[model samples]
Target: MSGVRLVMARHGETAANVQHMLDTRPPGLPLNERGHTQAAALGARLAADPVSAVHASVAVRAQQTAAPVAAAHGLDVRVVDGVHEVFCGELEGRSGRAALERFMAVYEAWWAGDLDARLPGGESARDVRDRFLPALDGILDGASGDIVLVSHGAAIRLAAAALLGDTAETRFLPNTGLVVLRPDGDGWALEHWDGAMPVAGDVTAGGTPA
Candidate 1:
């Protein structure tokens, strides 16, 4: 395993999540009660690991989700601008079956490698990759041990598929769910995807003991 393990986590359920609303603005929305619970559970689970750094999107929800984990490790949550949720543009605050359908369509295009597709007045897949991958690379370059990056679900899904590959596991990350990746030569290899942590291990490389 590589010394630098990356844990990409989706923020816990928010009121927006429950309503299926799209809220992408920075310093955006707060988490509801259920989201707090999920965040706590995720934090407790990660407390057992040797996480050295905690990075989160600038969005309020992402910072809120990362709070418990950062507190547990006595680490400050570093807000990275690039990891913020995709700017929804015309879709912001829109909710309903039709809105969701449209959102998913654009998302599917991103997964299919249509990097230029975007919502009206919004960002394209390439825009996300441009900012997100560089921020991720910066984190990896600076970290010596395990790292936790708390971000939005769609953002993580798209970036993971772009950086790793377009696959089922890379398509969606449940709220508070996480995936583990370690460097494999020039790229990254997925070690775990929304799965249980190993019951025993060093907990540094971000994988369950085999």
Candidate 2:
């Protein structure tokens, strides 16, 4: 049976991302200059495909990132709260270096397959996976043609891990990177990861944007 194609891309860089800050709060800052360029590039790349839908996290950066692509495809950008970045809680608005240090500590535990280890007042990796996968499953079940999901790094990583049936370490997707998955039976199959940007005019077997 033919299955749905899910094209997931990380949001463009934000001012916080460029300055190495932790932006976990609502209405966080918008994208920086380079971030706008990146989003434009991503939109140009995605224009080659027939994107039936564009979904984004509700964060300012993510919404800004999805705007260009949605406009290019003539699709309304739907904000899905479920795909928001993991809540950093106390770490919100902290410097990126501090967040990195803390993230590394959490990552170490994640590498050891400990899903419960979490930053203070934040969701665990397992928590992210649990929330995101079901949302993704619903998207897949109802979607046809090509669907573009613009989301944060951590949430996208957890969802990719769930789809690929791998640990967190196996799911390192770069900012603005693209991961394409196709529904397979009751699960999903990873068709490509960090593949060429669609601007290069590369189309996958399932006609998804990469």
lDDT of each: 0.78, 0.71
lDDT of 2 at 113: 75
Question: What lDDT score is found at residue 67 in candidate 2?
Answer: 90
Against the true structure, candidate 1 reaches a TM-score of 0.88
Best by TM-score: 1
In candidate 2, the residue pairs with backbone N, CA or C atoms under 3 Å apart (3 or more residues apart, or in different chains) clash, namely 20-96
After superposition, candidate 2 runs with Cα above 4 Å error: 1-3, 96-98, 167-171, 195-210
> Would you estimate the TM-scores of all the predictions?
0.88, 0.85
lDDT of candidate 2 over 56-101, digit per residue (tens): 8778788888899999988889887677777776777776345556
